[model samples]
Target: MSLESHRAACAALTLLVACGPAMADLQVAVGATSESTVALKVEVDRIVPLASLHPRLELRLATGLLLLSSEEEDGNAAWLLSPALRWTFSGERGAFLEAGIGGALFLETRVDSRELSTAFQFEDRLALGLPWASGELSLALTHYSNAGIKRPNDGLETLTLGYRYPL
Candidate 1:
């Protein structure tokens, strides 16, 4: 990872920690990507009530791990932690944009020559959710990247369909 990426990661984490006490929602989610990989993630999102401002706002801080597997190939894993800002249009039904910066550690044994690489990953996702009695179904488009640290860093773009249950 480059110095700049590291700095950015640290700064984001610091902000998340400072703002942790205000957030109070816990969510567990599961989703699948276009690459035939599944992701299970959990998040604690706190709504920052901004009644004083127009069009109320909320912020989220989340940390989770993603385990990726291919049926015809070996599996890979990544550790993810991100902080994001969200603006609500109508409480239950709204659009949100979030960005996450984390570390992606690829498994060495699965590679062709036992090569291992760790890179800084950043992802941006846009989501829409339909709230249910106990959970919500979310549709999202996500772009994942290694921030140019690795050669041929043609990042993975995925469309994720997910369900989240409040926990």
Candidate 2:
């Protein structure tokens, strides 16, 4: 009915699809990144079942929160939501390649000033895992920009390393 309602419905549908009958794996990761500022993040992703028609290897969903600190100002924070598709190659070890698009919301706060803005993000990720140990290591690259919303369009790029435990 409304924009917020639409977004909520979309999110729910995405989650439902991510957890369908073909789901096989679930993982949670914690990591940090180097970018405009340093940030720490926690993320979760699940493997989606592939169908003959769809032919995808996996589906993923993740959410992260990042904080950037400044010596001259208070700080800034961002919330990120992403959904991705991945292809896995199984070997003595397992490896995967992934790509996704998502949105981010940033809130900036200084001693007495505050601002809010939004951006769209494109991301690429790679990972290797050990099935016996239930451990995985991953690398990600992300790019962010305003999607022509007339808001602050300052762009940001980040590189991250992550370790995940399957649960």
Q: Would you estimate the TM-scores of all the predictions?
A: 0.63, 0.62
> What are the candidates' C-alpha RMSDs?
7.9, 7.8
Off by over 4 Å in 2: 1-36, 51-56, 91-93, 109-132
In model 1, what is the error at residue 84, expressed in angstroms?
2.3
RMSD of 2: 7.8
Predicted structure 2, TM vs. truth: 0.62
lDDT of 2 by residue, 24-76 (tens): 33443344333335544445455555645455366677665444444545445
Candidate 2: lDDT of 12? 49
User: Please, what are the lDDT tens digits per residue for candidate 1 over residues 64-128?
Assistant: 44445455445444446555565665754454544444444332213222222334566666666
lDDT of 1 at 13: 45
Clashing residue pairs in candidate 2 are none
Worst 10 contiguous positions by lDDT, candidate 1: 107-116
